[model samples]
Target: MSTDSTSLKLKKEIEEAADFLPLLGTDYIELYVGNAKQSALYYQAAWGFQPLAFSGLETGNKQSASYVLVQDKIRLVLTSPLKEGGPINRHIDKHGDGVKVVALWVDDARKSYQETVKRGARSYMEPKSIEDENGEVVLSGIHTYGETVHVFVERKNYHGAFMPGFKPWNPAYQPEGTGLKYIDHMVGNVGWNEMGKWCEFYAHVMGFAQLVSFDDKDISTDYTALMSKVMSNGNGRIKFPINEPAEGKKKSQIEEYIEFYNGAGVQHVALATDNIIETVKKLQQRGVEFLKVPSTYYDTVLDRVGQIDEDLEPLKELGILIDRDDEGYLLQLFTKPVLDRPTMFFEIIQRKGAKSFGKGNFKALFEAIEREQKLRGTL
Candidate 1:
């Protein structure tokens, strides 16, 4: 791939993206961390998530313990190793408390597995049935770009708070929701040359279509460069951006993540909000740090993006970024690294009518990231 080329690889874009697996929305995101207890508490206190459920030795199930946190329709399952040499611990050592499963809510887990496997997705697991007094739910799995896996969850027949075995988690203190609605999208950082290979896999196996593509020309800055292509399933509910580093004058953010994370993994999770101003304000008050762009960025951004409904003052006050496409505009802000490794973070996005990622903000975003990398001595 030429770093200077602005042309799209037409062959790689799915002409008529398939719909073999009808997905509803994100069922939940499961992370393999070193400590689930503390992580759960951090989420509830910092992000305003509520304790929803728990699963562990109390149920005599597996060697790991998992705490499920909830806010609105969003669910996060944090799993930790109970002993030294277990699968969860291995993941923690390798990826350092990162996302493992991006589970999708589906209509049929059995058919979801069969159709995807037949279409060339690497089979992570066949459909399995799990039942409790509440009801029965089926699950299936398949591998995506790297070690990350996608689990198909069929819960039409289940009525428990979460999956079976996870009792209600009634912690002594529960925090209120922070106005976060659900997952807007998930972005992944891949190896230097593997972005298109997995994009094609999603087009075929997972029945996704190319929503948009940003070559080096669209996002390249003088010191940094990378290419991104967004993929979305039918109904436009799920979106994934696959990113790979491109040749540049300095180290790209995607390269830095792959280095410290030990391999390709989820770079960040974008959370949707109806009001980003209030949500980010509360988050900052609760100790969430965000990336700071130059004061000049807000000066001329309005000229480029045209007038928006949001007052320019608060957007600047909150360090929020703005972008516009043919459809409409969106307001987004980035949080600093959620863990010590600088691997995973969060994106707070509020879309008015825009159906695209913030292409216009890429240069500033990369520059902000580069500043952080220099401080860490990684650039």
Candidate 2:
């Protein structure tokens, strides 16, 4: 297995673009960090994600660290550079640790790469074929905002559960998964006047259609501001919201991420689960701390939102919150920043046939975050 840059070959754009629609779901999310072992353990224990595969010192990966973790349908690979002065280390030092790869499962890798490239995408990784007895798998990558990337995965020919050389991690340990079945959404934070550039990239290069748009007025506090536009595939299985900080009294969260990360990058990943109450219960028991809203917010929740399916008792019991709009309703809770810096968080979300993002919950969620900021002295 040659891991040389020369082995990477960029595919030319196809004359007729590949039908890049109807994304099945997220294949895997890769995060570049400072420590993959500890981060893998945290996901396995706290997030109820089990170890699916791993690669490191024993596997002849002498220059880096990596681990693949799974929870039901969701798969995440954490990778950190072993030595300093590399691209991965620079990403961690600047971004304070965040997602680096959003791998999308496709039928054809070369065609997918060609289709997106023809639409004017800047290439990150050229289409490369990795194979073993299980068969061959082709992969390609394109640049997105910040240091983030979208990897196109063509696995129809590969029969292996994951990539080659990874043993099925079956430990005596099994924690109740946090109802997160698949990735519901992944948000990106871009720099000022950069949202449109990235949005246009997705729209033209990847054939993504705009799902929704929100301005600083849509999601803001008196002290901070942000503008967002959500892009999704035709079938809507994949959703990405691009955000840029707007002028505010103080530095906005988007601004903070861009400043510390030294550029644009992913902000948070919202994982989907069928049963949020059970998921939250298990996560809480395992040391995953979520942001908490004041009790008073719940007092007027029912009156403002009217009737819903779930009983209010269970929601309050698990500290889960609900918000509704004319379109539909969504249940979401945010994890406190997990990394050392005040950046990179997770959103445990369950959508009950809702298509819209949880806009109604912004006020309560921001206030909870503000409370944390106050304690950290960042506010």
Candidate 3:
């Protein structure tokens, strides 16, 4: 087969795997920020991410700022600029607040690095070691997007809950956690004509394969549309869905993201919890505000989608939305813009049995976003 034909065939097989995405779980999500402390507080108080580790003035790593937060199975590292001129600062100035690293957990960092590089991947960093009382940790990285990277983490040598220096936070003000267990999927919005390029990068460079695809025709509305392709590793644990907006009567959400972000970058990080109602409630009390959906949405949810295993009352109370597909049902909710710029956000999701992105709810969810855009004068 021709090279392009071979790739297309491989992509088709990958997407059809469905529940077989082989990802172990999320290692850590690193965000480049202007202020690590403030962002840390925002996550802890609003999102219920607990203080898991710290490194900075207090820890003697003063070159840059860092904070580590954790939930049941998720770890988030917040890094910021300590100097006026630095790469982190440049990224923030260009792209606003967004994910810089989507680290993956592995048994052997060195091998993962060697294998991917041998497969035509461009190296971002060589495998290196960080030591502490728990043990040693090895890590490596590969470039993904404009200023975005995927890091390989080998923690077999460590025994701590998170990386070293992060003490178990017993903060009195910590927000209670929602049942979010791990990262379900992370979606990125790229510039026009960039989706296929990135998808190819994942396929040839990182050994990932495209799993599912949606063109503007599938995802677009009369006013707006975008194309997307989901790529995943052999183990479905890690999924990266790339998107690019198509011309529309009004600005689509992908277009808005590219505009505010100033280039191609992550649009949202969808974190998966086990119990969304508990998670969202804790998130709300802690200060995280979700995109407002009317209470009336719950009125016809059951009638429209049929019965789910979860109680409808609590879901309605928390403004969590549900949808179904031939595969199964999934519940999810979105947070309002999480950064100063209207760029990046978070999604709290609970997957009962469904493996698909909430396609059934995209219309409702996008309309909810449109409401927010109208208020911000961006619609």
Candidate 4:
């Protein structure tokens, strides 16, 4: 009867017909940084990420060092170049420490790479096997946008601490997790007018399907504008929303990211949590700064989004936003730039049942972002 209900019905139909990619979920996300040890501490102290494993000169890798952190199903590998003039150094010099690899768990890494490469994807890594005492892992990759890569990881046979070269790292101090479950989605900011091409790459090459599309009118405020298309696999475990800057009165956030990140790169990581209030409290206590909306935005938010179960005060107190679709509602919040370069940040999200992203909170969310941009003198 309602628009939301009809949309939900169509969504189910689309899922039924979507192609299965024989993929599990995100295995891990690897980031290139200037200092792996320092960044690992930052994640531990700020985001309650437990030190899971590590690899470096300690593990006989002389070129680079990597620290693996885990919070529930989400894993982050922070890496840094140990030498100059290497690819890692070049990546950091150009992009200043952003997401480099989005590793996906799959049943067959070789088959996955073959399917995508045959569909016109550029090869980044040919399928290779690495074995250790635990077992062996098959890894393959293909270039996505910019220098970003999608790594298909077949670890069903491996049970080591992590991959092949890493050793288990259990430190004396570890931050308690903030109820973060896993990655909900990873958002990318492409160069001008590149969103459509990348979205097609996901659809045709990776066997993903377009879930939703947002134009500038829907995602912009008065000063900045961007267009985005959400793409997901058949089972809906992996989601990637590609964004491209649209013409606006001023430079859009996507454009700013592309400029500072030196071409296209990951914009933000959306991590799913179960309890918003508790997770926000824990993150805030650990010194994580979040974007804030005007308190006035919450005065009528409930009236607009319809009946919601969460008390408005906790949300307003923590700067969390809420939206309701046909299936249910979701609570979400955005973090300030994790780095000084204003390139990459994170999102903590909790979806009760709503399949849609927070379309209702776009204006308020962008306004909050614009305020941050203004402070940084980017807008």
Cα lDDT listed for each candidate: 0.88, 0.79, 0.78, 0.88
Ranking by lDDT: 1, 4, 2, 3
Write out the backbone clash pairs for model 2: 94-261, 146-264, 179-273
**Residue range 237-317, candidate 3, lDDT tens digits:** 778999988878899898888888888888888988777888788878767889867877888889877989888888888
Query: What residue pairs are clashing in model 4?
Result: none
Tens-digit lDDT track of model 2 for 121-173: 78998999987787777888888876788898877677776776554566667
lDDT of 4 by residue, 1-379 (tens): 0011122122232453244345677999999999999999999998889998999999999999999999989999999999889899999999998999999988788999998899899999999999888888889999999999999988777777788899999999887888999999999999888898999888888878888999988998989988999998876878899999999999888877888998999999999998989999999998999999999999999888887778888899999999988889899999998998989999999998998889999999988888888998898
TM-score of every candidate relative to the true structure: 0.95, 0.91, 0.88, 0.95
**Between candidates 1 and 3, which one is better according to TM-score?**
1
- Return the candidate ranking by TM-score, descending: 4, 1, 2, 3
* Candidate 3 displacement at residue 264 in angstroms: 1.2
Residue ranges of candidate 3 with Cα displaced over 4 Å: 1-23, 164-175, 294-300
TM-score of 3: 0.88
User: Scored by Cα lDDT, where does model 2 land?
Assistant: 0.79
In the predicted model 1, the residue pairs found to clash are none
- CA deviation > 4 Å runs, candidate 1: 1-15
Q: Residue 378 in model 2: shift from native, Å? A: 2.2
Cα lDDT for residue 71, model 2? 81
Q: CA lDDT of 114 in candidate 4?
A: 93
Provide C-alpha RMSD values for all models, in order.
6.9, 5.7, 6.2, 5.6
